[model samples]
Target: MDQGIVKLLPAVRGIAREAGEVILRYYTDTVTAHVKADGSPVTAADNAAEAVILPALHHLTPDIPVISEEQHAAGKSPPGDHGTYWLVDPLDGTKGFIEHTGEFTVNIGLIKDGVPVLGVMYLPVDGDTYAAAGPGTAVYGARARHDVPISCRVVPADGLVVLSSRRHGDRERLDKFLEGKLVKEHRHSSSALKFCLIARGEVDIYPRFGPTCEWDTAAGHAILLAAGGSIETPDGQSLAYGKPRYLNGEFIAYGRK
Candidate 1:
């Protein structure tokens, strides 16, 4: 890990947690949901959380620019520079959050040269924090006494367990894929949490054919990769960051090393 990034972990974690706290404040209290032009829900929590997170990221790494979900929805995009930058989904799983499922997450990732090198994903409901700075090592939560080391499974066998979205399940395709194979399914509301489950060796795979943006997966991708898992295109190509359109194609996260 770079010394700078190592030094930055606390700041990033603090920002994520604080933003999560802010989001939780307005989660269920606000009745009406704000929708974007595309008809996706955008609550006060999303904008409020981003307001807290983006400034903190800028203060932590003044030179690196931030690309956030709220900003992107507002018609902003990352620069064409090939240097490092921050990717943030200040309130992931907005629908879940709005529904008061308590499965939303605050994500922050450091991407360099088209790949993530450091990332943090924080779940406010449980106060769980997952972080990784590089390959082969991931530390979750605070470092003093509660932090736990996490890694992915090395070899997945038959009866493999997979995590699927609770709100976005596609029964037809999932049933077709699981047929003739021993499989167990676990459902979760947040994308980042699903990735954390795979990173901690609790799930074998997560496949998504639905639409998602770069910010939605960047943090989890970094943590999963650091824990020896991989996020790749359906055809097995590695997932790349900083695309012009910001929309991600179909991808699968494999648990095996």
Candidate 2:
């Protein structure tokens, strides 16, 4: 990444935090959820969060076009013709948020030359923010916690700590994938936050067989990479971004360095 682009990450993280606050604002109330054309849920939180993220992102990097969920819900298209852009999931885990699980998050990712180079994931309920850009990664926990640099730990000799999607895990596929692995523990989770967990080495791996959009994983993907971890296919290829329609296929996240 360019030094200038790396410098923009702090501002981007701040914007994601602001958008997370918007989510919290709606989270505290009885917000309604609506179904989009694809049968996915959307809520006031998603829109409000995007309203905060989109403009601030463009302000931070005027040349980058932002591709966000709500914007596409409004019929906007991705400017794939551009060499660099942003992928924003103003509110990730809408179902979790709607169910009041406190698992929802705000995701902001910067894509340069078709790869995610910067990412920020903010959890609103507790105001925890995890960010990664150029050469390193960091986390800002809530309650006056000092921002701390973070990295993925090498897998311990004991066993693997596996994380599965709380909302969309394919149990059979996962079982088959882990058939011969020494699994010490497993957790069910929702959203890109799982990627953050792997980034910080709290979890060792995450496998997703379900469908997901680019924005859904881009931010956390960047963070995981910066933490010296990786998100890749079962066959071990790094997930590439800016594909047609911004869709993503099955992939696995690994915490090992």
Candidate 3:
């Protein structure tokens, strides 16, 4: 691991935890939810969490620009070619959060050269924090004070399992994809947790055929890759970060070495 990234881990973890707390406060309250111009949902918790996380990240590395979901929805873009930047989804799985499912997450990722170099996904309800830098990844359940190494399971074909999205699901395509394959079917999960499930070796694949932004998947992708897994477009190209529009194409996250 790069020494600089190692140095950055503490601050990243702190910001993620703080942001998670901010989201949780609203999670337990009666909050208002609205749709953005793009027709995606947003809530007060999302803004509150971003307010806490963005500034903390800037303070940690003043030179690096940040691109956050709330900021982008407000038409704010990262100002310069930083070579390295922070990608944030302060509150992911807002629909689930609004429904009081406690499955939302605060995602923070460091991207360099169009790829995530470090990432953190924090679940406030459970106090589980998943982090990765380079090729090292771990899951820390904050309340439990336990750290578990995270890695994808290399299951044989017979044991293959796929995790899909519950909210933004595509049933027809998914059924077609799995028609001939011998695998177990599981219900979809929300947010980056789906990717984390694959990273932790609980699922073999996650194929998302619906729309998603860069911030939505970058952190999870980084952690998954660090955990000896890979995510790619359906065409088999590795998903790249820092695209011109910040929108991601449909992709498949695979649990494999």
Q: How does each model score on TM-score?
A: 0.92, 0.95, 0.95
Q: Candidate 2 on 60-133: residue-level lDDT in tens?
A: 77777889988987888554465788888989999989888899889998888767888888888888888877
Per-residue lDDT of candidate 3, residues 1-257 (tens digit): 77798679878988999988878877665768898888878998899999999889888999889999999888897765656888999999998898888889999988898888888999999888888888865454566687778888887666578898878888899888877777765767888898889888889998899989989988888899899888899888999887776899989999883
Clashing pairs for model 1 are none
Candidate 1 lDDT: 0.83
In candidate 1 the C-alpha lDDT for residue 106 amounts to: 92
RMSD of each: 2.1, 1.4, 1.5
Ordered list by lDDT, greatest first: 3, 2, 1
lDDT of each: 0.83, 0.85, 0.85
Ranking by TM-score: 2, 3, 1
Better of 1 and 3 by lDDT: 3
